[model samples]
Target: MSIPTQPTDPAATIPAVGRINWRAARAMLISEGRLLARNPGVVLWTVVLPVAAAIILGSIPAVRRPSAGLGGLSFFQLYQPILVFFAITLLAMQALPDVLTRYREMGVLKRLRTTPVSPTLLLFAQLTLILSVAIVCMALMVVIPPLGGAPWPRNPGGFVITYLLGAWAMLGLGMVIASLFHNAKVAAGFGSFLFFVMQFFAGLWWQRPNMPVWLRDISDYTPSGAAVQGLTDSSIGHWPRALHLIVLAVWGAATSRLAIRFFSWE
Candidate 1:
C-alpha cells in the first residue's frame, strides 16, 4: 500500500562509452616502437634491406646507364620507386602481420580488451609504428640515390601521392593476413611467400620492360607493380596512368574492409 518509489540516477540510464584514452594509446605506441627497434629482423627487413639494395644496385655501372625503354633514365634512377615500394611491402607483408598474429597468439590483445584502451588501439599503434619506419626507409631511399648521381622525381607531388596510395594498399593486405591467421609462424610463412611474389612482379629481380606482354599486363594490376609504375611515371614528370591508381585504390579499399570485418582480437 503506497509502498515506495526510488529515485533513478540519470547517469545510470546512459551507457558509459568514454572517449578514446589517448594517454594509453600513446604509451602503447611508444612501447611498440621501442620493441620494434629491438627486433633485429624487423630492422633488417624495413631498413637495412631496402637501403642496401638501393646502394648496391646504384653502384653498378650498368644500372647507371640510361636506357631508351626507361625514357632516358638509368635503371638506378627508375629503381628509387621500387625501393620505396619494397620498404612498404616488407612492413606490410612481414613485420606488421607477424607482430599482430603474435599478439593474438600470446593473448596480449585479449588483455588489452579488458583495459580502458580498446584492443583496436594496439592495432592502430602498430600500424603507426610500421608506417613511421616505412617513411624513414623511403626517405633514405630517395635521399641516398642522388648521392649516387640519380635524378630526383620530376613530379614530387605525384610521387608522394603514389607512394602513400601504394603504402596503404600494401598495409591493407597485411591487415588481411593478420586477421586471417591465428598462428604467428603461419602468418610469417605466408607473408614471406606473398612478399617474394610481389617483389618479382614489381620488377625487383626482372625488369618490367623485359617482362612478356601478358605477364606485364597482369602485373600492372597488382599493388606492387602499380606502385612501381606510378612512382616511375611521376619520376619522369608524367602522372601515373588511371589504371595504376585504380588498382591501388581497389586493393586498399577491399582488403581494408575485409580486415575490419573479420579481424580477431583473441
Candidate 2:
C-alpha cells in the first residue's frame, strides 16, 4: 500500500534563516520608496481629502464646540480618528493588494526565486513603505489640528498604541487578499468592497457616537470599528477599552497567519 502524505506548507519553500540581510532589505526599501514617489497619484488622492478635512474642521470654531447630538464630543474629536483610519484603510485595501497582484502577474515575485534576495523582502518593503506613508499622514492630521485650535489627543501613548494595532490588522487583511487572489482585477474588486465596509464601520458614513446602541455593539468586533472607538477614547483622555484592543490584536494575528499560510510567490 502507498503511504499517504500531508500537503506541503505554503512557507516551506522559504527555509528558516537565523539572520536577515539588512543591506538587501535597505536596498529594497529605497527602491520601493522611489517607485512610490514616481506613482504619487494614488497616495495623493487617497490622503488629501481626509488631511485637508481634518485641518479645515479643526480650524473652525463651530466644529470645535461640543454638540448635544454627538454626546458632547466635538465634531473634530469625533472625526479625527475616522479620518486617520480612512487614509490607512484605503492604502491597505486598495494600494497593497493592487501592487502585490501586479508584481505576481509581471513575474517579479517568481523571478525573485532566482535572485539572491528573498521574495519575502519585497513584501516587507511594500508593507513598510505603505505603513510609513499612512503614519506620516496620521502625524500630520494629529499635529496640524492642534495648531488650528482643535484639542490634542489627551492620552498620546494610547493613541499611538491603537493606531499601530489598527494598521497591523488592516495591512494583514491586505496581505491576505493578495495571498488569496491570483488576478489583479479580482483583487481590486475584492479590495474595493472591503474598503467600503471598513469605512462604514470606521464611521465614514455615520459617526460612531451617533450609531444606535445595538448597532454600535456589533461594530465593536470589527477591526475598523474597534480601532476607531479606541482612537476616540484615547483622544478624549481615556485608555482604550480592553475589549477593543483585544479585538484589534485578534484581527491582526488571525489575518497575518492566514496570509502567511496561503501566500505564494506567483
Candidate 3:
C-alpha cells in the first residue's frame, strides 16, 4: 500500500487547547450540573420536599404553640435546618449512584472514558452539584425561618461551623452509601431508611433531653445528634461544637477516601 501525505493544517494535525484535560473537566462540571438540575425527582427532593416537610411539621398545633424551655422559636425555625439536612442526606445518597449508573448504562461513562478527563473528574462534578444545591438549601433554611418568627442565630459563627460540619457528615454518609449501592434505586431506599432511623432517634421531631441518659449520650455521638445540639446551642452560648465538627470531619475524610477508592466506572 502507498503511504498518504500528512495534513498541511496544524489545526488538523494537533488537538486544540479546548480539548485539553482542564477544559474537559470544566465541560464535565457544566454538563453534570445541567443534568442534575433537570432531574425532576432531584428537584423535588432537594427543593420542594424539605420546605413541604418544614411547613407541615410546623403546622401541628403543639409545634405552633411554644412550650417552656423550648425557645419561642416556632417549630419551623427549629425544623428548617433539620429538613435541609434531610434533603442533603437524601440527595447526596442517591445522586452519585444514580448518575453514575445511568451514565454507565447509557454509554456516557464509556464515551467519557475516551475523553481527556478522568472518570474521577466526572464523579467530583456530580458531587459538586449536590453540595452546591445543599448550600443553597441551607441558605433558604436559615433565612426563611427567621422571617417566620424564628430567632436569628445568636452566635452566627457557631451556627455556620456546626451546620457546615453537619453538611459534610451528611455528604460523607451519602458517598459511602453510593459507593456501596450499584443502582440509584437501591441507594434511594437505603437513604430513606437511614434518614428515618437517624431522625427518629436523634432530635428531629422532639428534644433529646426527654430521652434516657444513655440514649441521650449515644445520640450526642451521632452526627445528626451533634448537629441538633450544636445548632440549638447557637441560641444560647456556643457549646462544645468542636466535638461534632471533629467527629463529622473524621467521618467525612474516611468515607470520602473509601468512596473514591471503591468507585466504579463500569
Candidate 4:
C-alpha cells in the first residue's frame, strides 16, 4: 500500500502580490492607456480649459503688470498656480473616481484577484495613467506661456516638488471617493462637490491674499490652499513654506491610508 498525497489547489497558490511584479504592472498600464484613449471624454474637458487659460493669461501684457489690488503681484502670477491646480483637482476628483467606481461596478477588480495580476497592479496602472495625464497638462501650462512672453517659475525645483506633493494628495482623496461610493453616479456627484471646494480654497473666485485673516488662516491647513500658496511662492523665487509642505504631506498620507483601508475589490 502507498500513502496518498492531497491535491493542492492551483488557484490558492497564485499570490496577491508578495512582491511587485513590474512586468504585469506594465502590461496593465498599457491596457489602461488604451482604454483611456478610447474613451477620454471627461479628462479632455478637465485639462484643456486650464492650459488654455494659463497660456492666455501669460500672453496678455496687461495681466502681467503688477496690480495693487492683487497685493503687488501680477494677475497672471496670482492666478497661474490656481489654474495649474484646477486641472489637477478636476482630474483627481472627477476623472479618477469615476473610472475606479466603474471598474468595481463592472467586476474588473474582483476578477483580477484570481489571476497572477493582483488588483494592486491594476491600481498602480490607473494611478500612473492619471498622473501622466496631469503632468503633461502641467507641462503644457508651464511651457506654453513663455512663447507669449510669460516668465517661468523662479524656483523650478521648489515648484515641481510642491506640485508633485499636491498631486499625490489630490489623487489620494480621489481614491477615497472611489472607496466610499460604489455607485458611479453618486461618486461623480461627490467628486464635483469636492472639486468646487478645492477650487474655492485655491482662490478660483476669491484671491487668498485678499481673504480675511481668520479665513485665510483656516485655508492654510487645506491641501488646495497650501499647494496654491506653495506654488505661488516658488513662482515668485521663494522657497515654499514648511507649514504648507507638512500640511500637504499629512493630507496625502491620511487620504491614502483611508482609501486602502476601505476600498473593496468586489
Off by over 4 Å in 1: 1-18, 59-62, 69-72
lDDT for 45 (candidate 3): 54
Give per-model TM-scores. 0.90, 0.92, 0.80, 0.94
Evaluate model 2: give its lDDT. 0.93
TM value for model 4: 0.94
Instruction: Name the lDDT value of residue 214 in candidate 1.
Output: 93
Residues 1-266 of candidate 2 have per-residue lDDT tens digits of 98868558857656466468789899999999999999998888889988899889899999999999988998889999999999999999989999999999999999987886789999999999999999999999999989878999999999999999999999999999999998999999999999999999888888888899988998999999999999999999999999999999999999999999999997
Residue 226 displacement (Å), model 2 = 0.4
Instruction: Evaluate residue 243 in candidate 3 and report its C-alpha lDDT on the 0 to 100 scale.
Output: 76
**TM-score rank order:** 4, 2, 1, 3
Candidate closer to the true structure by lDDT (higher is better), 2 or 3: 2
Candidate 2 scores a C-alpha RMSD against the true structure in Å of 7.9
Candidate 3 root-mean-square deviation in Å: 4.6
Clashes (N, CA, C under 3 Å) per candidate: 0, 0, 0, 0
Q: Per-residue lDDT for 1-44 in model 4, tens only?
A: 88777558867756564878888888899999999999988888
The lDDT of model 4 is 0.93
Off by over 4 Å in 4: 1-17
Q: Give the per-residue lDDT of model 1 (tens digit) for 1-266.
A: 89667658767655467777788889989898888778767657467877888877766778878899865778876787888898889889999898999999899999988976789988999989888888888888777777777667888888888998999999999999999998999999999999999999999888787789899999999999999999989988899888999999999999999999999898
Of the candidates numbered 1 and 2, which has the greater TM-score value?
Answer: 2
CA lDDT, every model vs. true structure: 0.87, 0.93, 0.69, 0.93
